[model samples]
Target chain A: EAEVAQSPRYKITEKSQAVAFWCDPISGHATLYWYRQILGQGPELLVQFQDESVVDDSQLPKDRFSAERLKGVDSTLKIQPAELGDSAMYLCASSSNQQGPYGYTFGSGTRLTVV
Target chain B: AQRVTQPEKLLSVFKGAPVELKCNYSYSGSPELFWYVQYSRQRLQLLLRHISRESIKGFTADLNKGETSFHLKKPFAQEEDSAMYYCALSSFGNTPLVFGKGTRLSVIA
Candidate 1:
């Protein structure tokens, strides 16, 4: 089975430090998403990308967080000056297209902890 | 706003017992509903979608438009079925999915 790849399974960073997470979606997937999951809450979308162009980033915190998919294939999410509240699991998912019954495929996720 | 709601945060069932995880949604337009499951130390994966109307691992979900619900159900639960299940909704088009808080199902022997 083709799986989404994510780097740095766990990360611990001090406040005011920068942290980044990487994700490589399955081949042929066109829509990629970045989501943040708090300890007790469901995952929330941070950004969505259609190929290399961003489709929606309304929930993303622009001041401190940034995400990009340079080649429309792999993506990277970065947080500057990480805050304690930023501790959570960052998940990456991808789908072949906007249509179809095949739901998104998610990566194992990168667990972030800011102290 | 589109939203998915899973009323129960945790549910427990004995092996061989029937299981149902409730899910409701608030969407004005035609919506797509899905159930995603995450096992221990595993990535979240799609268990089933309302569009498919197919049973997977003995699990099934029926989309009730009038009730605005798409609840996951299984005839008999197994110990391996214990996992965190999330109900998600997506509006028409290429919109992103909105997920509920999720329910932790524990099937004990």
Candidate 2:
């Protein structure tokens, strides 16, 4: 079974530093999403990309957060000048537009801690 | 905006005991619900969806539109069922999956 791939399983950074997380969605999937999950809470959508174009980013903090899917196959999420509150697990998920029984496949996520 | 809620943060049950994980949603239009599970040292994966109505690993959930709940139930809990289960709802196919806080189920041997 194909799965979403994410890099940097763990990261430790100081406040005000820039951090980036990468994700390669399942092949041929038309939709990809980036979510932030605080401990004990559900994953919150940060951004959504539809075949390289951003579809929804209302919740994304544009001042410090930016995401790109130049090729649509892989996407990258970046946070500049990170704050302590920005520390959380960043998850990537993908799904086909076909509306199959199986909805979305999520990655293990990148655990980030900022001091 | 679509939202999912999993009220139970932790649930403990003995082996062979019945178990239920509660989930409720807030959505306007017809909604799609799903349950995803993550075991220790493993990736989050799909467990089952309400549309299929098929029981995976003897676990089943029925979507109740009147109550706005989709609770997962298992007749016999197993130790392997110990994992973080998340309930999700997708209101629009063009949007992302909205997830709940998740329930941690521990089946004691």
Candidate 3:
């Protein structure tokens, strides 16, 4: 039962400050994803990565948000000049296959709050 | 665009009662459907997928292609079954999942 690990379970940052969240996917997982879950809403995809290359980031706010999997084993998501509306639960997930009946494994998520 | 729709925002049922969480989708081609559950103080995890066709924790969902629906159901609900359930859809290949607004199930004793 390997689990995805996330750092900084809870974070509070001032508006205009930078915030970053880290995620370490399960060993041998090739695909990783970053999602944002707003209160009372389902999680939305921010970015998807296969190994170190990005597969899809159409929904990601390129101006303020960026995600990278430098080594492909772990990944980081950063928001520059965080805004109040950016407060949400950032989730990370990993899977061995791109699409299959065996779904991805998700992390506990990092709760972000901007003041 | 692939989309998943979970109609009810919240569903409350008594323990030992049958439970059903409705879900519908809109996809042009064949898509994969999944049910993810998040318990209190726990991470989101996969409950079951339509492709598997296997019941988990007494829960099962049948994919109805004509109606474009994949609803999650259980014969008898338990208190521990209370959680937030999300319906997700994904196309073939390395596509990101599109999730619905989820339904909160409260199995009251």
Candidate 4:
């Protein structure tokens, strides 16, 4: 099965450091998403991208977090001055349609830990 | 605001027993409901969706509009069924999904 690829399966950084995660969505998928999943919580949307444009980022902490999907394919998410509270599993997902039977396909995720 | 509520943090059931994971949602617009599962050491994946109305891995969920509920059900649970299940909701168009905290199902032998 085609899978969404993510890098740096696990990362640990000191507080206030910068961290970046990469994601390569399944081929032909147009919509990509970034989500943060805390220890005991479900994944929460951080941003959504349609092709190369950001569709929604209302929940993203713009002061420290940023995401970009250039060329409407692979994408990257970055956090500067990462805080302890920012430690979580960052998951990337992609889907072909706004709504469909397949729904979203998720990556294995990058587990972040801030010391 | 679009929100999903999964009341139980965890549920334990014996093998061969019926299983049910409750989910409720609050959405102003027409909603699309989905159930996503994450197995140990595996990536999260789509288990089923209300629109498809199909049973996946012997599991099925029916969307209830009047009660605003979409509960996952299985007649007989298996050890392999143990995993974390999340209930998600989405509005029309390219809107992002709003997920409930999730329920960890532990099917005991």
Q: Model 1, B28: alpha-carbon shift in Å? A: 0.5
Instruction: After the best TM-score superposition of candidate 3, give how far the Cα of residue A65 lies from its true spot, in angstroms.
Output: 0.3
Worst 10 residues of 3 chain B by lDDT: B89-98
Q: How accurate is chain B of model 1, given as a TM-score from 0 to 1?
A: 0.98
Interface RMSD in angstroms for candidate 2: 2.3
Better of 2 and 4 by DockQ: 4
The lDDT of model 3 is 0.93
TM-score of 1: 0.97
Candidates in order, TM-scores: namely: 0.97, 0.96, 0.97, 0.97
Q: Where does candidate 3 stray beyond 4 Å?
A: A98-101
- Please, what are the lDDT tens digits per residue for candidate 3 over residues B5-95? 8999999999999999999999999988999999999999899998889999999999999999999999999999999999998887667
Model 2, position A96: C-alpha lDDT score: 83
Superposed Cα deviation of residue A73, candidate 1 (Å): 1.5
Which residue pairs come into collision in candidate 4? none
In model 2, which regions exceed 4 Å deviation? none
Best by DockQ: 3
Query: What's model 1's overall lDDT?
Result: 0.94
Q: How do the residues B1-109 of candidate 1 rate in per-residue lDDT, one tens digit apiece?
A: 9989999999999999999999999999999999999999989988998888999999999999999999999999999999999999888667888999999999999
Docking level of model 3:
medium
Give the poorly placed runs of model 1, Cα more than 4 Å off: A98-101
